[model samples]
Target: MNGDKAPVRVWCDGCYDMVHFGHANSLRQAKAMGDYLVVGVHNDEEITKHKGPPVFTEEERYKMVRGIKWVDEVIEGAPYVTTLETLDKYDCQFCVHGDDITTTADGVDTYHIVKSAGRYKECQRTQGVSTTDLVGRMLLLTRGHQQRGDSEYKVERSRTESMSEDSAAKSPWTGVSQFLPTTQKIIQFSEGKEPKPGDKIVYVAGAFDLFHVGHLDFLEKARAQGDYLIVGLHTDPVVNQYKGANYPIMNLHERVLSVLACRYVSEVVIGAPYSVSKDMMDHFKVDLVVHGATPVATDVDGEDGDPYEEPKRRNKFMLLDSGNTMTTELLVQRIISNRLSFVERNQKKEAKEANLWKAMNADQEK
Candidate 1:
């Protein structure tokens, strides 16, 4: 009978906004524990009512989770309150969540009901990386270089460790498999995975913030044009100069993983320049440069500026059809449309994460 049993179905659910290595690692661990790993993404309304304004919408979160190498099926609109009925509906034997405490406004644990029902399981959270830490980095970037006081326990070391953690298949998340560079990813982007004989190298650059279908489609099209696709991601400062208002909801490393996760993307330039220069082209041996149909941004002089200026002058520039593509602008507007609620949600989250971080520090001091 034991040999005849069907594969066990494991279910893990979360908001998964600002999907990162930590989330990926958790999913990987959950996946390793069972045969089939299905992730449930709570709806935006449920998340907003509970966790606060998510950097990414439920829809965006759904896509991001699906893209993770460890994830199998993704259930949209999973109930915020996980019930035995919810588990039964999905044919899941049990639910998995991180060890971190995620409670409600009234200090009610969301998983309490499920845990009491004996349908809950906990997974060890990976140390050194979290969405809260990343968000803090973004907020503090504007503070200019400042050092933490001797009395204040520093989060700097953890931040560096988190930053340096690879998001590819080699990440701590997946059990046996990690993202290994193909020749193209090494050559073009590093790039990795060396190109085959006579293979052309395609170059494209952008903020690629809040990476969406538009970015995916654009990258896919670019990949089709050449054997190797190298995507240059601009710095956050460069992105801000062009795309004001806390642009690039996700950071450089986050954006890098988002792009590198895409099958169409062969490699990535972590901090690529805003403008395409001759040296960059020669360095990467770029045969072509592609841009989406989105409008270009201007420089400090307020003059119309295209980053791909040199590519055009070299007659290697081309425009890809993004097909009514979604932009970071539209994505931002969606969150902004619910601005008051979103802002309040973020503030609450900041306060909560801050308190938790402080408590952790205090415990360590003790």
Candidate 2:
């Protein structure tokens, strides 16, 4: 209610399983069209019945949606189908989604009702990434996608170049695209705030691939420890060097946006050093450095001792349990274990989308 004229509330709903920067980007766009953004997350049962098994549970998906910076409210266990009644109940002026297909198991568009009522709008889908593509990368163990470092100049190059050449060979449903990153996009996602004086700035660093509930929980706990929480996002090459074997499913720019979108993050250090040096700590005015319970990967070449040595020496380091043991490795195993299901799911989804496009085009021709 802006001066008696109601605010333009926007509604966006999805399963949001394996939440990524793509999802964040969509939410950001949806929010920009209205004063308030209300995101509805489908539950696990509904998602499994309609879209196949979700990577994350309903509770996790709900929490992840709430964490997105642009999301003003979250409706848990929302219906798979968007109804005008749902919108009117929430007083939303319109609903929004990405320019991608979302259908039920019976090949019905989830937003068809809203579309028919002229209560829906579409935003550009972020290219080069999707849950299906990420699952395929895990199932195929595609190591070439990892960003590699050119030691001579300390520069990094994305393997997506080579991967793009072979894109024609891949299924349209699961094919990967080269993610075009821009400083403007980064600026849009960033909080862009400096820590105030007397503020305790807590720091943590990681690859944060997949950006699941585990990362969300860890960030929440870390944020509780300080006035401002600055996350250090390691470069893709650095993550690959440490994790080795098709690691960092998301690239550096992707990971940067993912971390910055989290509500718990006050700021992020892009391409942060793997080793937290004294100079680095002093630079951020970091009062404490926290690490999750997962075993720390050794330094890039193992030539440098422990990565946390500087923090340890300064007595500013603390080990956080986070309670949830989920990791990116565990996520890969989940995808690999259910490879056939996800593969079939992507194929069916693409087929349904193609059929819809054909029908729509035929109508337009008529």
State which candidate has the highest lDDT: 2
Candidate 2: tens digits of C-alpha lDDT, residues 216-325:
99999999999999999888878888888878877787788888889999998888988899899999999999999887877574675789999999999999989988
Error of 2 at 147 (Å): 3.7
- Give residue 126's error in model 1 in angstroms: 6.6
Query: Residue 295: error of model 2 in Å?
Result: 0.8
Location of the lowest summed lDDT over 10 successive residues in candidate 1: 169-178
RMSD in angstroms, all models? 9.0, 4.6
State the C-alpha lDDT per candidate. Answer: 0.68, 0.82
Could you estimate the TM-score for every candidate?
0.63, 0.89
* TM accuracy, model 2: 0.89
Task: Estimate, for each residue in 115-147, the C-alpha lDDT of model 1 and write its tens digit.
Answer: 998888888775544554444435333211122
